[model samples]
Target: MKKHMKLFSFLLALTVTASSAGCSLSGKKNSSTSSSVLSEDDEGNEGSADGAKADEKKTDGDIRPQDDFYGYVNYATLKDAEIPYGQYGTSVFMDESDESPSEKIVKEIGKSDKKYAPGTNEQLIHDIYAQAISYKDDGTAEKEIMANCDRILNAGNISELMSVYGDLTLNYGSPSIFQFEVMHDYKDSSRYAMYLYPMQSFLGTSLESIHDEISKCEAPNNIARDMFRIQGDDYDTADEKGRQMVYIGMDIANNTDFEGANDMGHLLALEKTSFEEFDSIFSNLDVSLIDVFCADAKSRADGLYVIDRGQCEKINELFTDENLDKWKAYIYSTYISSMGYFIPDSSEILSDYFPKSKEAEDDQAASVVLNYLSKQVSEIYTERYYTPELDKGIHDMFDEIIGSYRELIANADWLSADTRKALRKKLDGIKLITAPEPHKVNAKDAKLVGSSLYESDKALTRKVMDDKLELLSSPMDRMKAMMLSTDVNAQYLPCNTINVTVAIMQPPMFDPKGDHAANLGGLGTVMGHEIGHAFDSNCINFSPEGKYDPSWLGEEDKKILDERADVLTDYYSKYTIMEVFHVDGKLTNGENYADLSGVECVTNILDDKEELKKLFESYAKTWCSLSVDSSGIERLKTDEHSPEKIRVNAVLASNKKFNEVYDIKEGDGMYVAPEERVSRW
Candidate 1:
């Protein structure tokens, strides 16, 4: 899976016009165009139910455009549109497009009553969906939910609590104290390695944010208390218990040495330690947490773990017997929260505690069904939409984009010979996976079999965990694509690989018959954006061979890149969203830098005046979106990428080519002076 952060722009990360302020999932608008803008009526505009009202849109000459390009192009278009797919952007539309295979499969599954045989992939998919939507007749779902709740309450010690939490994560995909996954060895990106990450409660939010009112804490502690109270506790007791849970969370944040946890630091500062050393350094969490939670990890020939020593040390502080009450309270709260998924009656409580969009609320059952069956659904989608020609087209476009990057790097004046060589080596080594490979559910050890929805879900979870555990001792297969081909997204994995799924390669994003301008604007730009990640600030820690190495860039070259990035930071920091929410320039610099590089790469490949103009228009169109909603406000704080409107406007503002093509003069909405424009490519 792509990391929680550091995603490429497009699909979810990219923008484009919608029917209203929020993004639309389906469209019925016809393609409309102007010399300066591509209207929603253009090709691929089929069923989008988002974007500004056609009557409300001011012609380019009707009004005085602000120097704020994003405001001029995107802000006035706001009309509080509905987010049908629950998310507000191109990603939603891409996933729900008429051509979307997953959507088709979901609809197909929803209309079917065909019984799948046990031990088959279809059966697993059916069971996951049936259980998710509460359509299963058996009482296993209720039992499953209660059983986990019982486990939490039954934990008599901190060690036992840790074990139960791990079980919850391993079997039910619930939140836990720590998270683990099979990832490319940072030291050797070509191979798989197990990575243990501190839970989001520790890393997702800042310390100050964590200390805010219960309303501000991760999910409402008050709700957790309410759930506990409902279980049997009196009001006061439940409230105190909830407070204890909140306090433990706060303490974790307060004691955490959060000085360096940024993208670059995530790669550079963490030290690798053996399991024995891990046991000593964070003894409270070692064998109890790792062994019981992930037995395969303990038995592996390679027992190495990478950790931020400072963070782990603080975690140790919370592990004493003296803090057992707090630990137990937190455990009980999370266990109840986890049960919310299996218990349909708990939806009301879960809704109030956890943030969710209206679409998510209304379509909860359907979304859950599709999500749990993602692998199988993706397979169905791939079978319907994927083709060799489509794959080849995207692959060819990616290669060309790489070639463009090579030319840009070759011409870069600031990079020294050695630094450029290292960069080229990394670029050359990038493994591109453009298609989804074959996937089959292994039902070899599905013990939770029967007519029980809960048992079926438990079995599915166990199977997933088993596969993950197996990866701990297995060799990484370089040829295997990590992401599903049917996924409507693209990514640049830090493993020196770029994955552009076939789903995203469809119309609107990558038109097969479209002119160079449209193709380059959409798909071409995406290719460049992903390639930029290879050399971005966060990814720069790795050498060309994908080994973790900070020496890739010489000191002088690093200074130059840093200075250039500072200019970008300054430029983006000036843009404020939702009035009070300011963009986190440093946090978003990597993606912003990639946006600039992507534009440069695309522009470098085009020479014809008409083609350049279309490319510019297409690029702008790619990021055109309606007004942003409040839900996006939180994203502004933590998301690595800036808003879609900002991505398009900011990147264009920094490009001389864009200025020339659009005829943007000084003081124009889209203009940025040559001296102020920032670019690292």
Candidate 2:
């Protein structure tokens, strides 16, 4: 699955109402005890009357709020801020959650003298981490990679070439002409479906983007030439080959109908067809490559795949010997790039190609293991930190936030009776998945234990693939947790489910004993934001059954939604980031819409003036972050959500409640005039 599977909005919050007195609680265990827990007593050190004052003084430095709210709230820290080594930014919640738990887990597992139980999740993580730290850069991996490249380059015919292509893609994570995968059917939302789309380059950049860069001038080609030089090519020859390969990428991008700003969101909307129909259009070329990725479903895949007929036809016409040769080079380069760490002289060869981070390869490998074996990590993380009390507190907080959303829908004047009823049903239909389900390891698989790391990792990937292929003929597991409980994030699945990962449930993001005001500001807002996605412009029309059916919305209500959404687009588009790039308001509209609804919902829950003040301050500090200039620009270009600064200030400015709580006067940075402010509620 693509890393973009997580659909998140900007989220932050504070504690509950004052009426819930003495509701002190501790969040998940972390080393930073200073602010991890809160006491409900009046004289408690944190989240007390004095605690709120301390936060105001700590954050609201000398800068005038009217001139710059982000600077005002964040300047004192930003002035002396140091991005953590090997990281772009840090937060109290993020920093505490990141290192302490994972590092501790690794340390504990590493100390074990005996081998972990065979075929258990513990065995998998232990082997992967142990192998990573002890990895020796021998010439063997490079030789294997070169041997595969040679096979592709020396193929005798289209059938032979395509077979080699299939092996690389299915086992080695390389892509040939196109890619195939099994995922939840968008049209049905309750069953698995097969999708075939144009192949994406292994390089971080997409084909269209890479091609555009090469077309600009010789700079991109010169860079590619350097990469090839590292692979043993002389300068001039590498330069020529680099330019030719880029042109090949351009041709593929053009032929695939993904020439400009293409993403899965766009491809999902394109015309879909059965595998038989798709292959008929490409009969001139061998199309059996599809079966290689589909595994056991080879025969059953007859009419299972949904594809873009136009793109397939164009790709079929473009598959000639000359183009195939260029493809070989392209694929070889990408495959080697992916395996750089495993190759000899990998550091020097890849130093210029990949970012320079202070982290060691072993640590990166450990993270990879954690990600791939998230179910295991989730189990360990929960056992050590998650408690029944924290679980109940979080669920209660979620209910409170959802209550606010329900009130908003109940009172929405813009929604007609029919549209409002449909919207409410859709909202009520949303399911909640908060923790990772137990992973049932197969003790019977020999490769699960007493195998080399490389072999074990390969087996794991194949296992995951086989499971997905099996889903092709089975029902979708809608309640399955898609993320590790240890990840510090929440998401709204389009399948009418909200996933609150266990990691994000920890403090300072969501404090149990912390001021309900602060918890409301941080976690409450997050819950509201995630739930708000169901009512966002794109998702508002989805049926209660989770199907994307715009007919659920009345024509008049749809018009109102679009108009309000445009307000958000115009408002956010004007905010500049890094002095050069502006937020892609249109791209970020859905998230921004959620942000508005979230903050508004949280604000509606507040009644006490002092508590409200604390919530506003807590909300602002949650978004307090400083990033490298280059990273900021990259975020503006690629991130669907607005920059952190814009997420804080733009969101605050949109709500009248923020102004009332903070006494944000006319011209204040936090004040958006009534006419300019866009309130989705």
Q: Top model by TM-score, which number?
A: 2
lDDT, candidate 1, 589-657, per-residue tens: 889888888889999998886897667656655665532244456577667888776687667767877
List TM-scores for all candidates, in order. 0.79, 0.81
Superposed model 1: Cα runs more than 4 Å off: 1-100, 110-120, 130-151, 172-174, 202-208, 214-219, 257-262, 281-287, 304-311, 340-366, 413-422, 440-449, 552-559, 574-584, 626-636
Give per-residue CA lDDT, model 2, range 89-172, as digits (tens): 444333332355665576567546767777776776777777766655466666777788688668766566777776776676
Q: Model 2, stretches more than 4 Å misplaced?
A: 1-61, 83-100, 135-146, 173-177, 197-205, 215-243, 253-268, 280-284, 298-317, 337-368, 578-582, 628-634
lDDT of 1 at 95: 26
Tell me the lDDT of model 2 at 452: 46
How many angstroms is residue 366 displaced in model 1 relative to the true structure, after the best TM-score fit? 4.1
